[model samples]
Target: MVRKKREKDQEIGGFLKSIEKIGNKLPHPAMLFVLLSVIVIVISHFVAKNGASVTYFDAKAKEEVTKSAVSLLNKDGLFYIFNSATTNFTGFAPLGTVLVAMIGVGVAEWTGLFNASLKKLLINANPRYLTPIVVFAGIISNIASDAGYVVVVPIGAIIFAMAGRHPLAGIAAAFAGVSGGFSANLVIGTTDPLLTGITNQALLASGIDMQLAPTCNWYFLAVSTIFLTIVGTLVTDKIVEPNLGKYTGHYKSDDSELSELENKGLKKALIGLIVYVIIMSFLMFPKNAAFRSFQEDIGKNTLKEFLDNGLIPAILLLFLIPGLIYGKTTGKIKSSHDLVEAMTEAMKSMGGYMILSFFASQFIAYFGKTNLGVLVSYNGAKFLDAIGLKGLPLIILFILLSAFLNLFMGSASAKWAIMAPIFVPMMSNLGLSPALTQVAYRIGDSATNIITPLMSYFPMIVVFLKKYDEESGLGTLISMMLPYSIFFLIFWTILMAFWMFFKLPLGPGVPIFM
Candidate 1:
């Protein structure tokens, strides 16, 4: 009877496959970025030429521009594109951050430190607790930079396969925790500093007399970490995994034997990781330590400076030093050639990402050059501020607006770059703190990342799915993950609204309102 049921399921899948050939027809990510960019640029041009005139008060104070597409597109014109492209080439693009962070990550992954540790941990973990464990690990993995996407995600799939569950379900759960819960984490990460720097710049641009700390949203994010972990676990098991049904596809098991040396190496890696962290904490904790920031002002502490300015070095030592130690001890890497080879192998895996990023960067540059994002955000914020809306309604409206804009512009920093200057100031006028406003912006930006095809990581996720089921395509992956996206958008928005209504502080020294 079970065999017959399986056969029937396969037949049903075949029938549905014929009815939906949607995934195969989708454009390549590179082409999609290029095409969408051109469309937005053209629309911006027309908007600039014919749209109503409005004045913006900022660095370019008293700026006036028509709402016509042509006028909007011609606002900054080629200058914006040139500047954005230059920044991309200079390693400031998101791709650059991922690439640089992966050097250390590559060493760790190549030395089998990450995989072996995960396997060993999972081996002892209770099967019933796997969902939450994987989800939590995904969120926690953010501290290791792009390691969440590369390591936790695939391992989730593999673990699920070993447990006789659909691997895609595991992928969905992990992706939800990693990308959907992007703004929520137990620990600070490279993104925290990167985004805080941008937010600080925006605040400064508004002529605000304040110091925007990177940890401004830490408390709220920490709470959110717990919330998302529980919610992610529930949604994965109750909704996502069940909907995915049983695994009928071929999947590799994780019962393979590990060598004695590999086991010893993992043990050494664990010890090295702990020791490295302790040393780093010691070095960075003291005010006059060699590695501490050389700032003299007590208020302007060195720890803060290091958190903001020296994140790259922090990431390197946090992962690389431990990884090098593990490799040397484990015999995975004995010579300089081995180290170089590990890094080189990691770069080779990034070939697809580089291609995707090149087009994504161009699109983002074009979008900025056309000034559509700026014009829309400016006008939108102006309209909202003109009204007397306050508290929850205001936040809900902004979240929705942010989500809508996300469909067209995928880069969080880039979109915030355009929106923050206007929204922060506008919200400030309405008696809201810039930190609160920034947190709201982050929620909206993160909520939709899982659903948006325009996201740079979206294609990579699709690729990950194909590994489990050769026939799986964009539609299958999107369909499977859509529930989580919807749940996150609604639930996270509600949580933010509640937080606002309750007058909660986002983090230490962070205000709920201006």
Candidate 2:
């Protein structure tokens, strides 16, 4: 049995190594977008020349419509390429939402509010209940984007070591929650707007005439946060800890707790959060509230306008208010200049994302201008119809495809930018909602993040691992995380199936079907 287990581990290690090699050979994500843009231009010219087109019934219009590929190689296309460059970058849906959201998030993170809150959650946990708290804290860290990777993950290791448990188990549990639960969160964060903007852009460019708010997946993802916290804690206590054996390593764990001032700041931040919530409630809850619309024609959906138009700013303020309060209480920010500098630091970190957005925006623009997305979606819908691949089986297949693609490409937004334009509309034609498709894509993208060496944070995880086990390497990290990835994929997919079977609303007014 021992020999057989060793052989199995060997095989798995070899397979992951191969995936790593192949994935590494792929271009940088920004460069990949550049390549995809070129491919779209070339393929569009060929398809247009061949006179290929698709005819499909438009449910919104209640009529049949034909879509043909538009060649970017043509004179008009060349002019568009030059003339629309600035607009393409500016009009990118995710650009403004992400930037606006990040500015607020930046203030919070810069104030050390996010870091202190996460540490407090883990530090105050009862020894017996530490695992779940670590996992839950990791999951909650998603609200601040990549903060969990830097803060929770290493702290998880230190906390475990202090508890006389295997630090790698701690790392596994925290990493599982942070990366594996990337898509699942209690509150709508930057990711919601980021993905929703891409989904809306795809639908609008494809002439779907429908829109979704950033909170479209909030209800389902909130539930998933609890579910994954349980799963991550179990995997750590049951599977991972036992496999790791006793900690014979001599690495010392940090025993520092949150400072008194930080605790004070956190309390004040909570007050700030409550005050902000109360203020927003007055604007949204009352029938005659500023954000609420009491039009009889819109039925019971009085807050639809706020949900659609005002949610982003609300999220921005949710982070900004608490962060500013924390900073003031902690003396992290004493003046307007200090506050400006903190915000500036946050923008500095976003320079890479901005670069990526420029290329991604161009790729999405090129894809839409060529009309290839519509043609592909129509034909793909027809193929799926012919094969009778609608419903659960189809959704599972898409999730698996997304998981497979994640092994090669790590960025959730980057992968979705390419996939959303094709699948969102195609799936809609087959009776699925854009929200449902986006949810499936997120499930796949998230489940595999822990195991993928290509993930941007993978190296950081390795660094955390090395602090406990000097001998640990990429294979060690992959092997340790493999169980979490498998279970997440299986159970998360099942949860998605459950949602589809019951036709549950994923979020407010967001249904499983179009």
- Best prediction by lDDT: 2
Per-residue accuracy of model 1 over 358-426 as CA lDDT, tens digit each: 776676656655556666666666676677677778888887778777766676776676567777777
What is the C-alpha local distance difference test score of each model? 0.71, 0.78
TM-score of each: 0.76, 0.64
Which candidate comes out best when scored by TM-score? 1
User: Looking at candidate 1, what is the lDDT of residue 366?
Assistant: 63
> Worst lDDT window (10 residues) for model 2?
56-65
